[model samples]
Target: MSDVPPIWYEFRDAVYCGEFQVAEKMLRETPSLLHMANGIGETALHFLAVEDDQRGVDWLRTKGFNIDTKNEFGTPVLFEVAQLGYKELCAWFIENGADLTAQDRDGRDIGEYLLYYDKSEMADWVRKLGA
Candidate 1:
């Protein structure tokens, strides 16, 4: 069996399935898991963004989750959502003061990365935001 903890899988599954209640319960039980990483190196906040779970994202932020944190690939929270065409999530971060021009390790800004992912429309929008 994998040495990974059982709660780890539970949390990941909860986020994957959009079971915010289950995820919240797990966080309530073991609050530190909020910032803990899964096997693939995604924190609970990352999953929340991936799912566009606004409530979960807000709850995590209230718990002190760093919105500026990077994933295993050095993708920031804002960039991750923007690349997914999550306009609401992108606007939330941008309006809330995320660096508009923050680049990944490869030096690709948000617009460039969106274009790289073939999200031409999103790239245009991000560029319009001057990010």
Candidate 2:
């Protein structure tokens, strides 16, 4: 049996399926949902990252969701996007001031994670940002 709530699945599904309006309505109706984490401590932002939903991420940011919010493993949304090689979304996060030096629980930086995940292009892009 999963420790995650049923509504969490619904919410994650809504975001993953690109049903932004449904996600928005759900969030508005249950504001606490934003703070709710699933079994892995991943919030809706993690789902948005997985789907590469930059606009949805921006919307959530405006709703006061922390860009640096970490999951149980201490991986922030930016770090997740970086390793996934979502250049555009990662760039958007960078432009919007996502923490560049954020480390996971193991103290591995985003660049290292990117490189380890074979996202050298993303690693280069991130390096250029700091240059």
Candidate 3:
């Protein structure tokens, strides 16, 4: 929010548009962009998760970014994407070290959200994982 760099917007636009190659090129030139958060502390990982780009997520993780990076509200990238009902992604996150028990400032964990949004199967799955 504070005078974000023009390239950051370009980078975000590329990612949002599903142009991972272009986004990767931009990041290659501006490596710090990987860790740069927006006004609310959301990073490129958040966008990639929303896009369901597992490869992109893995790429970011290989670059040393925490997959559990939280936004200002304490919502992790995995939690944000769980609402979309991507069961495979949910499984991958849990298998790859995502914290299923992570909660937001509202005291809501992934299971609470999955159940709230009628994702009973996902809720049940995460519940089994100790969410």
Candidate 4:
């Protein structure tokens, strides 16, 4: 078993719960754990995607986390936000220089994948971002 620190688990849970302040504290105290993922290969950003917390996303970006980082299943931050139809978050991510053309494990581009998943609005948003 890998000897991951307790703060790593706390950070993941905090992220999933949208507790940005706690997550930030944990991250600041243990910067090395910022890149750690949870049981499903979800990094802090993946949890933030579900939380849809723009503030947390901005904080993470400021902390130097890679916006385009993918989980083990190859799902990028944009993919998750798009799937959830979070237009503002998706637009923010695009403005911050996320790769619009990145593909997932199935080799589907972000736009195509969103449409395939019946997220037409998000697919349209992706198109608007020039994906």
Candidate 5:
């Protein structure tokens, strides 16, 4: 069996725990770790969505990470951020060309999910973007 790199696990854990500083250090030391996924197929962006860190999101976006990458569940980064009512992150995703119409594994569109979560304002904003 091939030995798994310890830094990869550390990077994934740091992202999950919102330790952007540590994650960044790990990325700088081992750029290949940036592509590593968690058990749920979640990348650093997915963890950022869970942590709701706008700064971290902005930093990752600046690093040219794929904004629309889907997790194992088929949920896009923007969808997760939107579901959490992260207006700024959602707006950033929109500005950066995230696929607003992308759906999750459950067939729920981002706008539909926003409406379901009682975030009609965000849903309306998404609708306006498409118009």
Candidate 6:
């Protein structure tokens, strides 16, 4: 009998299974689900990051979801996509108000984190956004 919220699991599954349509419908129907996090504070955005589904991410943005929220570990959603090297996603995050200067609990800033891992393409894109 897992006591985790069903919506959170459903939201995560929708992203994991690449069902953006379902996710979109649910979010539109229940906006607060956007703020629903599990025991670890991971929302549907985190699942999107894990899936690397650009469309799902874009849908979330179109719905006015804030991508800058920090996770349970104090890491912003930017950190989730940092290693993926999705140039478009990274750029979109910056354009949509994601904080490049956000530091995680480990004290690593997002731009630095991108460069430290040699994600030059993404690093270059972020650098153009200024310090």
lDDT of 3 at 33: 92
Clashing pairs for model 3 are none
Candidate lDDT scores, in order, read 0.77, 0.80, 0.77, 0.79, 0.74, 0.74
Give lDDT tens digits, candidate 1, residues 47-83. 7788887666766677667777677788887888987
**What's the lDDT for candidate 1?**
0.77
Better of 2 and 5 by lDDT: 2
Deviation of model 3 at 90, angstroms: 1.5
Cα distance off (Å), candidate 2, residue 43:
0.6
Error of 6 at 26 (Å): 3.0
Quote each prediction's TM-score.
Answer: 0.76, 0.83, 0.77, 0.83, 0.73, 0.74
Number of the candidate with higher TM-score, 3 or 6: 3
What TM value does model 1 have? Answer: 0.76
lDDT of 1 at 125: 90
Off by over 4 Å in 6: 1-3, 15-25, 115-125, 129-131
Instruction: Output the TM-score of candidate 5.
Output: 0.73
- Per-residue accuracy of model 5 over 1-131 as CA lDDT, tens digit each: 43556666676567666687887887888887656666677777677766777666667767656778888878887877877777777777788788867888888898887887898887887778771
Model 2 RMSD in Å is 2.2
Tens-digit lDDT track of model 3 for 1-131: 47667787787777667687898788889999978877778787776777787776766777667888888777778777778877677677888899876887778888887777788887787778666
State in Å the error of residue 92, model 2: 0.7
lDDT of 4 by residue, 71-95 (tens): 8788887898889888888889889
What TM-score, to 2 decimals, does candidate 2 have? 0.83
Candidate achieving higher TM-score, 5 or 6: 6
TM-score computed on alpha carbons, candidate 3: 0.77
